[model samples]
Structure formats: structure tokens, C-alpha cells
Target: MARWRIWRPRSRAVPFLSLLLLAPLVFTGLKAVNKIGLSSERNYSRGHVTFVTVFTTYNSDPAEASKLPSNVVTVGKHSYSKVGRSMAILNTFIGFIQVSMPRSNVIILTDPNSKLTHGSAVILPIEGNYSRGNLMLQRIRSYIAFLEQRLEELETVEDINHLIFTDSDIAVVTDLGHIFEMYPHCHLALTFRNNKGQPLNSGFVAVRGTRDGIFKAIEFFKEVLEAYHLKYMEASRMLGDQLALAWVVKSYLPSAFSKFSKHEAFTVYNWTPPEGAGQFHGMPLDVK
Candidate 1:
């Protein structure tokens, strides 16, 4: 009788074939898992975000004759004053943009003496006394102080994830939600340069709602203003509000915030209208 040997597939061969078939499956499964994990992580991190814009206006210039859209709040003069008109125009633009964007919350800050309409915008009155001197500088100082005070008040009332400050003269051209998506961890975002290549206009700034290092910035501004006795274009240049703001960022909050270039999204400058697309120039109309 011929010796009968049971022929079995080589154990090594079976294992090798199994691995060959499973290799693609294993890789595909890992890729899917990774994708799901990343998606979940992104969604989880995207917490509730609120958008805010603040404008400071004083009732001085008559150029404030323009009109803003309904959503904007013109906070300065309240009684058809130049500041009111300017703020009105400004608020109009802001209201238009806010309506166009639909997701942002807009507020207008004005002197307590302002007579702004109730529904036009959230009107925040300046609370403390502003010492008389260097009118423009004093106004800027008071505005900044008002902003700080308002921020504190907001914190007390609700949770704010971020705050963006924009001068009435800058136009918004794009949805800024992408910015948050790009730099989710950043505490502040600001425009560093204008379309004309001018350097450092604090016309636009974005800051986290936390008050952690904000007081330091305020202190720096106070020091600059006091030391320079900022007044007049030349004297103000020595320590202008924008310059003081820049100094604070450089000296105190460099790493605490991030700045974006204006060329990236929008344009801001002294508006010379009938000439181009920029905020209106002069008082009242520009204040909104």
C-alpha cells in the first residue's frame, strides 16, 4: 500500500495570504478611524463664538451727514449732531455689513450725552469723567477706557469668547469666521498694515474676552499719553492712540495676540469719497 500523506496547505503560506488580503483592509480601517477622530476633534473644539464691533464718536465734524443701514447704532450726538450723523452713516455701513453677515452682534459706544435711537444699536454710554486736555487724545483715551469698562460689563452679563474693535472708517469685505477657524488658539487678531502700505493702524483689533492682560495695555496707553502730553498732530504723533496701542502690544502683549494684514481681507484709510470705496471722511458721518 502506498503511504498516504495528508497534504495540508503550508501554514506559513496561509498566514501570508491572509496578511496580503488583510493589509489593504487594515490600512483603510485605520484611515477611516483617523478621519473620524479628526472630525470629532474639530467639531468639539469649535465652541460658541460671538462677534462684536465697537466705534467711538465725538460730536465735532459736520461731515457726518451720511446714513447707515438700520442695524447700526449711531451713538454720539443723539440730536442730529455731526457726531450723530457720522455715527449714523457709520452705523449704516456697519448695520449693512452685520445684516449681510447675519451672525455677528454689533454695539455702538457713545458719550452719555448722546441721543441715539433705541433699536438702531446697543448704546453704551461713557461712564467716567474725562479730564480736559488734548481733546482728540483725551477722546481716544476715554474711548479705550470705555471699551475696557464695557468688556467687564459684558463679562458680568454673559460669556464672550472674542471681541473685535473696528474704527468707523474701515470696511469689512469678507466673512471673518475663517479667521477663527485658522487661528483658533489666538487671543487677539488685528490689522497690521493698510492697502496703501501704511504701517500699523489700530483701526481694527480682535481680542479674547478674558481680561487677563488687558489692564496692562490700558496702563501702557495711559503712560504714553501722560508722558507725551499728546496733543496736536505733531505732538500726538509722538504718542498717538495708534502708537500707544502698538507700544502696548510690542512691550506687553506681543505673544498674547496675533495680527492680520489689511491686504489680506479689507482696506482702511482716510476716506476721500467720490474718489473711491472707503469710509466717509470728516466728523459725525464718520463717527458711526
Candidate 2:
């Protein structure tokens, strides 16, 4: 009679044990369904008109340029061959992006001596003579000038609203359509590395094409360059373009720059692999 009692209890508990085991599986299935629904909603919310630009010299190597994804626009030097295989790779990358994102635009700025064919991109000849010694600074200045020209060119068109600037070395693995959703109020968005708890990178940035805040930031960068005499020959080299950009925006318009909290948003991937693989990676294309 005691053995019979034990078997009776075990039979009763079997159903309870089975339910407990199945509870987690049921919850996991519902959670996955919820995630799929949310992902679909986010996809519908993606913006359509986003602009991306890259400033490259004629000397950039093709191998480095080939790594750029298909969503970027290439701004190259006048003589395509002079810029070397790197610029050619850049041109090819931009071509791919142009095909993928049909609504996007690519502009290449080159000197009068450039031999590049004007294909799908708008070719803007370098306005004045500038030396290669101050090429980095000059490239920044020319890019701003190119922005103004492109904005004017698109004045009649209402589709383009945001501008994204990326260095040639950066690569995009995910679709960046979400960035356009953060524009206008979020005048500027860029990735930065934590410099011992401070933001330190500026390889990638997004700006509202119509915002005056960017103009103010650019002027501040110019002042810093001029004040330092555009020469970093000193032991304490005046901050590079990225540092200068961060300081100018943080100092002048704190409200404008959106600092990325996660290190993966904009980072030096050479030292450490990005915590998340899909975001973006800013690699150094140059040897230095």
C-alpha cells in the first residue's frame, strides 16, 4: 500500500514537471516573434535620402579603396591615374554604391590636370592651386567648398537632406539608412573612441546639409589650423584633423555634436577588434 501511494504521487507530478520544462520554450518562441515584429517596424522607419562623401587624393592605393562599401560617394583628384590605384578603387566602390542606392549622389573634386572620365558622378575641378604639403588641411577646406556647391546643385531637388563624411579607410557593413532618421535636430553625429574616458575619434560624421552649425564648426577648425600655422613640425604636433574637429564642436556647439557612447560606433580596429562586428570599422589605410 505504501508503494502504491508513491506511484500515485509520481504520476500526478509528471504533468507538472513537463509544464515546467515547456515554459521556457514557449517564452522563447514568443520573444523571437516579438523581435521579428519590431525589426519589421524599424525597417519601415528607415529614411530614404542620405548623402555620404569621401575625400581622396590621387595617390591613394587601389587595394585600400576597394574595401569601401557600396553606399559611399567618392571625391577624387582631377587626374585619376595620378591619384593611383587607390583612387581607382575608390571610384569603383562609389560606382557600386551608386548602383545599389540609386537615389544617392557621388561627386569627385579634382585638379585641372586630372584625367578622370566624368561618368555617373559630378566632377568639380579644384578651384585654385593648392600645394600637397598642406594637402590634408586643403582637402578639408575643399570638401566644405564642395558641400556648398553640391547643395546648390541639389537646390531644386527635394530628395537629398543629410550629408555623411567618411575617411577613405572606413568600411560600412550594415545599412546606414537609420542615421538619416537622426538628422536635422541631431545636427552632427560621429563615432569617437574613448580616449582614457574622453571621446577621441572623428573618422566618420553625419551632418544636416542645411544646418548652419556645421559651418560654424568648420570655421573653428580653420582658426585652429591658422593659429598653429598649419605646421605640426613641433614635438607636440598640433592635433590632427579628427582631434581638431572634436575640440571645435565640443567647444563651440556642445548641443550640436552627438557623441557616440559605444566604442564600436567609431573606433581604431587595428589595436582591438570591435566589440560588435556589424556596426562600422575605421581602419587606417595609410602606413602611418
lDDT of 1 by residue, 30-71 (tens): 111111111111221133333343344443332444434354
For model 2, the local distance difference test gives 0.41
Candidate 1 overall lDDT versus native:
0.41
TM-score of each: 0.51, 0.52
Per-model C-alpha lDDT, please?
0.41, 0.41
- lDDT of candidate 2 over 4-63, digit per residue (tens): 000011212112110000000001111111111111223211444344443435434434
